[model samples]
Target: MTETLVRIDGVTKRFLENGTPAVEALTAQIKSGQVTGLVGPDGAGKTTLLRLIAGLLLIDDGTLRVCGFDPKTHAAPLHRVVAYMPQRFGLYEDMSVIENLELYADLRSVIGTERDEAFARLLSFTGLESFTGRLAGALSGGMKQKLGLACALIKRPRLLLLDEPSVGVDPLSRRELWRLVYELVDQDIGVVWSTAYLDEAERCASVLLLSEGKALYQGPPQALTRSLEGRTFQVRNISGERRAVLARALERPAVIDGVIQGRSVRLVVGKGGVAPAPGDIGAGPEAVIAAVPPRFEDAFMDLLGGGPRGRSPFADAYASREHPIDSVVEAQDLTRRFGTFTAADGIHFRVKRGEIFGLIGPNGAGKSTIFKMLCGLLRPTSGTARVVGLDLAKAPSEARARLGYMAQKFSLYGDLSVRQNLEFFAGVYGLGGRRRRDALKRMVETFALGPHLDVDASTLPLGFKQRLALACAVMHDPDVLFLDEPTSGVDPRTRREFWSHINAMVANGVTVMVTTHFLDEAEYCDRTALVYRGRIIATGAPDDLKERARGAGRSDPTLEDAFIALVEADDRESLA
Candidate 1:
C-alpha cells in the first residue's frame, strides 16, 4: 500500500464573499512518491486548498496534517519541510541567476557545501548552466519558470506545493520540468500540483476535482475519462468558420461540450444522446462522424456544466473586406543581439490581412524578441519591420498607432479597479468623452467584465484578467494585433472564448501575429512559424507541418510532435 504524506478531514475554509465557504468539507489524501493534481475552473478553490496545505491560510474547521504535524498549530515546522511556489515566484529580477538561487537557498536555511551542491544539481537539471551570470529579468518566460522550480527545490523539502508552475511555459520546458518532478518523487517527495491544463492533470497519479470549494471527484485521471467513453465524438466536414461550427455544435442541446480540433470539431455528446449523423448539422454525405475515446479535458468540461455560453459580444466589430495591401506585416532580415547572444537572427515573415499567424519555439528560441521588434518595443540590430505599409524604424508613431499589443504578463495596474483600467487605456488611445464612454461600455459587455468592474484588477480570477488584458489591448481597435502568450494561464473554455473574439476580428480584416506555447492552439492559426536557436526552422499551415512529419512514419502527429521533429531535424542539418 502507498504511504500517505498528507491527509485532510472535513476541512473548510471560509471568506466574506457574501459569507460563504471557499472550501467546504474538502477531504483528500496525498501519497508519498505520488503526484496529486488539483484541477477546476477559475475561482474553484484550487489555490485556496494549496495555501491551506502550506499553512499560509488557516483551516476554519476540521483537521489537517502534513508529515504527522497539524498545519494549523505546527505551522513553523511545516514551513521547513514544505516548499510552495505560488503563481508568481518572489525572485529578484535585478539579481543574477546565481544570486537569486543563493537568496532562496539562504531563506530555506541551505548553506555552504549543501547550497553549492543544490545549485549545481538544479542548474544542470534545468539546463540553466550557461545562464548563471545572466540577469533574472533577461531570461525567457520558460527559463524563468524553470528557475522558479530550481529555487523551490533548493531546500530539498519533503513536500512540494506547485501552483500553476507551467502556466506560460512551452511544451518542451513543461516536459522537462515534469521529468525533474518525477525524479524528486523517486526520492520520496510528495507533490500537490494545481493546473488549469487538463492534459497536465492527466499526468498525475490521481486528481482531486474541485468546484466552488467542493470536492466533486477524487480518483485516477483515466477513471474520469473512462466514465465518458462512448459519449465523445468528432464532428467532421465542418465547412463553416471555426466559430460558426462551434456555435452550431453548442446550439444542439445534445452537445454538452465542443472545441475546434484541426479541421473538425470534437465534442461530447450529452448523456442519452445518439451519435450525430452527417446531415444533422448541414454536412454533405461525405462528412464523417465517429465516436472516439474521451480525453481528460472533455470530461472536465462536462463537469463544468458544459462549454462557454453566449455568443461573443465583440462579433460585429469587423466586416469582411478585400485587402488592397498584400502584406499587413513584414519583416526583412530582422536581427536582435545581446552582446554575443543573438536572440533573433535574420528572421523574416509576412502576415496578410485577415490572417492569424502563430510564432512557436522552444524556450529561449527568440520568439518574444522577434515579437518585441515587430511591435516597436525593441529596435532590431539590423534590417527592418513594417506594419500596414509603415516602416517601424522610420515611422514608429504611425506604425504603433495601428497596432494593439498584449505582453505575456498581465501588464495592467494591479491596484486599479477594472473600470479604472478600461478608462485609463481608453484615454491613452485618444478617446474623449463620449468616445471613451462608448469604448469602455463596449469592452465591458464584450468581455463580460460587468461584475468585476468595481473589483481590483489584481484580485480578479485568471480568466477575468485575460479578458481585461485583451480588452485593453483592443480598446483602440487597431488594424493589427500582437499577442504574446495572452492566454497562458487561462482555462480551456476561456481560451476558446478568446480565440472566438480573435477569429471574429480576423474575419473583419484585422491581422494578428501571436506567439503561444500551447501547441494545440496552433490549429486555430492560419499559419505557424517555428523558431529554434533564433532562426525560422519551419513555417506552414498546421496541416502542412503535420503532413511533413507524417512522412517520417508518425501517423497523424500532433503539432507538438511535429514541432519536436522539426527542431531535431534542423539540429541534425546544422551539425551536418
Candidate 2:
C-alpha cells in the first residue's frame, strides 16, 4: 500500500471575510511516489489549496494533515517536509547561478558536503552544469525555470508543490521538467502540480479538479476524458474558410465546443446531441464528419459549460479597412546582434493581409528578437522589416500607428480601473473625443467588461485580464496585430474564447503575427516558421510541418512532435 502524504477533509480557506472562499470544503488524498494534479482555471483555488497543503495558509475549517502532522498546528515542522514553488519562483537575478543555489542552500540549512553534493546533483539533473558562472538574469525562460526547480529541491522535501511550472517555457523544456519531477517521484516524493494546462493534468496519476472553490472531480484524467469519446469529431473537406466554419459550428446549440484543427474543424457535440451532417457546416458532399479521440482539454471545456459560443462581438464591431498592399508584414534578412552574440540571424518571412502567421521555437531561439525588430521595439543590426508598406527602421512611428501589439505579460496599468485602462490606451493610440468614447464603449461591450469597469486591473481574474489586454491592443483598429504568448497560463476554455475573438478579427481582414509556446495553438496559424538557433529551419502550414517530421513508428504526428523532431534534427546536424 502507498503512503498518503497529505489528507484533506472538508478544508476551507478564505482571504476576505465576506468574499467567497478561495477553497471550500475540499477533500483529497495525495500519495507518495505519484503525481496528483490540481487542475482548474484562473481563481479556481488551485494555488490556495497548494498553499494550504504546504502550511503557507491556514485552513478555515475541517482537518488537514501533511506527513501525518496537522499543518495548522505544526506549520514550521510541516514546512521542512514540504517544498512549495509558486508560479513566480523567487530567484535573485543579480546573483550567479551557483550563488543563487548557494543562497537557497543557506536558507534551507543545507551546508558543507551535503550542500555541495546537492548542488552538483541538481545542476546536472537540470542541465545547468555549464552555466554555473552565468548570471541568473541572463538565463533563458526555460533555464530560469530549471534553476528555480533546482533551488526548491536543495532541501529534498518529501512533498513538492509546483504552481504552473511550464507556463512560459517551450515544449522541449516542459518535457525536461516533467522528466525531472517524475525522477523525484520515483524516489518516493509526492508531487502536487497545479497547472492551467489540462494536457499536463492528463499525465498525472490522478487529478483533483476545482471550479469556483468547489471540487468538481477527483479521479484519473482518463476517466473524464473517456466520457467524451464518441461525442468528439473532426469536420473535414470544408468548402469555406475553416475559421468561419468553426465559428458557425460553435454557434450551433448541439455543438458543445469547436476549434480549428489544421485543415479541419474539431467539434465536440453535447452529450446525446446529434452530430452535424456534411451540409450543416457548409462543406461539400464529400465532407467527412469523422469521430476523433477525446482529450482532457475537450472534457475540461465541457465541464466548464462549454467554451465561448456564437460570433465574436469584437469582430462584428470592427470596421474593415482596406490596404493597398497584399503583404501586411515583411521581414527581409532581418538580423539583430548583442555585441558578438548573434541573437537573430538573417531571417525572412512575410504575412499576407488577413493571414495568421505563427513564429515558434524553443526558448532563446530568436523568436522574440525577430518580433521586437518587426514591432520597432528593437532595431535590426542589418536588413529591414516593413509593416503596411512602411519601412520599420526609417518610419517606425508611422508603421507602429498601423499595428497593434500585445506583450507576453499584461501591459495594462494595474493601479487603474478597467475603464481607465481602456480610456488611457485609447488616448495613447490617438483616439480623441467621440472616437475615444466610441472605442472604449465598444471594447467594454464586446469583451463584457461592464461589470469590471470599476475594478482595478490588478484584481481582475486571469481571463478578464487577457480580455482587457486584447481589447486595449485592438482599440485603435490597427491593420496588423502582434500577440506574444497571449494565452501563456490561461485555461483551455479561456484560450478557446480568446482564439474565437482572434479568428473573428482575422476573418475581417486583420493580419496577425504571433509567437506561442503552445504547439496545439500553432494549428490556428495559416503558416508557421520554426526558428532554431536564430535561423528558420522550417516554414509551412501546421500539417505540412507535421508531415515533414513524420517517420516510421510515428504515423500520426502532432505539432509538438514536429517541433521537437525538427529542432533536435537541427541540433544533430550542427554537432556533426
Candidate 1 residue-wise lDDT, 1-576, digit = tens: 468878999999988755689999988989888899999888889999999989899998888998888986898999988998888866889999999998898788898898889999999988999999999998877789888889988887889999999887888778888998899888889998899888899999999999999998999999998879889988776555655666666668788777766676777877788766666665456668888789998888878777766556656855566657899999999999999989999999899988889999988899989999999999999999999989999999889988999988899999999999998888888888887888888999888899999999999888899899999999887899999998887788788789878877877788999999888887888889999999998999887888788866787788888898898899899899
Residue pairs in candidate 2 whose N, alpha carbon or C atoms collide under 3 angstroms? none
Worst 10 residues of 2 by lDDT: 313-322
Displacement of the residue 472 alpha carbon in candidate 2, Å: 1.3
Q: Which whole-number lDDT from 0 to 100 does residue 418 have in model 1? A: 99
Q: What are the Cα lDDT values of the candidates?
A: 0.86, 0.90
Per-residue CA lDDT of candidate 2, range 408-476, in tens? Answer: 888889999998999888878999989888888888988889999999999898889999999999989
Candidate 1, residue 571: the lDDT equals 83
How close to the true structure is residue 480 of candidate 1, measured as C-alpha lDDT? Answer: 95
